[model samples]
Target chain A: DAMVIQNPRYQVTQFGKPVTLSCSQTLNHNVMYWYQQKSSQAPKLLFHYYDKDFNNEADTPDNFQSRRPNTSFCFLDIRSPGLGDAAMYLCATSTRESMSTDTQYFGPGTRLTVL
Target chain B: AQSVAQPEDQVNVAEGNPLTVKCTYSVSGNPYLFWYVQYPNRGLQFLLKYITGDNLVKGSYGFEAEFNKSQTSFHLKKPSALVSDSALYFCARGIKAAGNKLTFGGGTRVLVKP
Candidate 1:
């Protein structure tokens, strides 16, 4: 099935260490997004790429960065991992046609644990 | 400020009983609405959406949602609850002015007792 996939479902990293989370999609959607979801809270948008044009959320921290090397692959880079940053990171994809109405498909998510 | 609201933190329902998850949004213009379901340790799965036309929208896994313009609400419904249906549900909205992002509700956990 054409779906989104994330690597290393669970990740463990030390404080201040840099870690990368990967996401790839078979759906070939034009838009890819990264979101941080804390415990018992709604998933917060971090950044997204609309066909190589990166759009970052205003409130997103500097430690968080993302890169879409190609249409099928996107990576989230944590420059400095913090205990508070340990949460499920989700990647989603959608089409560019009508952003307000298009449905986003999501991956299983990568759960990051800070040590 | 634009926001999506899911009033209930959790909803408990007996198996075979009807289930309802309430959601309300405050936004400008006509916004697109969506419902997503998340199982434990999994990403959200799209359930349904409301763009225009039908007020009542049916979706996967026997789920349906009603869009009420006056109330600014889109509530999800299931005629018969199942034990397997227990999960976290989130309501989201996409406003054209907000760019390419969906503002999600706080989420509502549903527990269907068998």
Candidate 2:
């Protein structure tokens, strides 16, 4: 099965410290996305990468950044983690053909706990 | 702007009974609806999606969703619920004409009694 994979399922970061969450996919989809899902809330889109082009959401803070060196691997970096930054970070991938159908496949999320 | 809504925060049903999870959406153009399920500490698994041609779309785990365009609703249904079906259900919608950001509902926690 071609599945999406994430590293460091559970992470604890000190306040003001930096943290990075990684995601890799076997599906080799054309687009990759990062989402932040807080407790009991819908996941919010932070950013995404279509092939090598990066697109950031409007409300996403500057503290967050994403890097996709290639198609298989994507990384999310949090410059300075705050208590409010504790949440589950999800990574997903999708593809668009001529018809432009978007169906995303999600990976197991990284749970970040900031103290 | 595209958005999705799950009216019920939680739903409870017996194991052998039918189950339904409600979802509604708002979008500029035609809507692409999707349903996802999440177990404890696990990633979300795609249950089903409604693109076109079919009002009742069957998906993984014996789950199906009906697209009601007039009511702007896409509710998930199962003929017979199972205990393993208990999980967090999320309704998501995307407008391809606009952008790719999938607007998701708050999510509904379903509990199937044994």
Candidate 3:
């Protein structure tokens, strides 16, 4: 039952407050990714970690940051949550071998609500 | 740059009827295509992928996709639709050198009426 898991399925934070969403995996994949998915839109890639190397998307905002402390854990940090930042944040994992074909497995997303 | 296009915003199908979700792509070199399904309040589940070889690829939950090189399209299909099959479907494209970064299309929501 190797799968990706996200903590605090639903999160509520005040505007301008910092919040962190956690993701852990049992799949032992070499890559971990964070995506922001607004209602009725495709999941947009925010950043990802290829092993220990962090890759950020060009359009990703400065308020968004990520950390991968170890293979199994990755965290997304929002330095200053905005009302527009309220969306479902998804974490996904994939092996280097399978990544070429885009076989990423996703965790249940964390829905963030900024008040 | 790799990009995907899902033309339809939503598709409506009757139960037991065949269903098709359209997808097209633009990428450098040979394209790698994938289809994923997402239920309400849940993460996306992989349905199938097309890399090489045969044009037709079968995947989980009786879903299959046909890869057309000439059309630059990979369309997902099912012989018989079920009510439980209703969900949001996404098409994505990946490049071999891009690691795990996938360019996804705006999703198409499928509604199977029972």
Candidate 4:
């Protein structure tokens, strides 16, 4: 079935170390988004890619970066992991042309633990 | 800007009883409302959405939501709550013309006791 998939459901990284979380989709949607969800909080949008164009949220930290190397794959790279950065990272996809009723499909999410 | 609000942090309901989760939204243009359910350690699953037309929209898992234009609310409802229905519920809003970015509510955890 067509669905979004994320690698390394749980990840552990040392403080200040670089880590990458991967997301791939079989749905072939035109838009891909990355969100950070802390415990007991709503998922916050970090960045998204409408095709090759990257759109970053205004409040997203500089340490967070993302790349959409191709239509099906997107990667979130943390330049320097911090304790506060430990949270569930979610990846979602949607077909933008269906803008009015577009529904985002999500992956299981990668849980990052910064030590 | 588009935003969604789930007033209750948690809701407790008895099995087989009716349940309602409150949601209010703010949007510049016509609102596209949606409801998603998340189980523990799992991704969010879409339950339903209201794009336009009817005020009542039925969706997966015997769930439904009523859209009130005047109240700026879209509350999730179920006739008979089930124990398996317990999970975190989220309300989200998106602008008609703002691409596909969604603004989600803080989420309300629902507990259905048997």
Candidate numbers, best TM-score first, in rank order: 1, 3, 4, 2
Model 3: per-residue lDDT, tens digit, B21-100? 99999845668889999999999999999888999999999999999988989999999999999999999887666556
Q: What is the TM-score of chain B in candidate 1?
A: 0.94
Instruction: For residues A1-115, write the lDDT of model 2, one tens digit per residue.
Output: 9989999899999999999999999998988999999886788999988899898989999999999999999999999999989999999988855222478899999999998
For model 4, residues B55-95, the per-residue Cα lDDT tens digits are 99999999999999999999999999999999999999875
Instruction: Please report, as a residue range, the 10-residue window in candidate 2 chain B with the lowest summed lDDT.
Output: B94-103
Worst 10 residues of 1 chain B by lDDT: B94-103
True contacts kept of 2: 0.40
- The prediction achieving the highest lDDT against the true structure is 1
lDDT per residue for candidate 3 within A1-115, as digits (tens), equals: 9999999899999999999999999999999999999996999999999999998989999999999999999999999999999999999999978657759999999999999
Per-residue lDDT of A28-104 in model 1, one digit per residue for the tens? Answer: 89999999999957999998999889988899999999989999999999999999999999999999688689898
TM-score of 2: 0.95
TM-score of each: 0.97, 0.95, 0.96, 0.96
lDDT by residue (tens digit), candidate 2, B12-34: 99999999999988845677888
lDDT of 1 by residue, B23-87 (tens): 99885766689999999999999999999998999999999999998999999999999999999
> Of the candidates numbered 1 and 3, which has the greater DockQ value?
3
Candidate 2 lDDT at B41 equals: 76
Q: Cα lDDT for residue A94, model 4?
A: 93
lDDT of each: 0.93, 0.89, 0.92, 0.92
**After best superposition, candidate 1 residue A57: deviation in angstroms?**
0.7
Candidate 1 local Cα displacement, residue A90, angstroms:
0.2
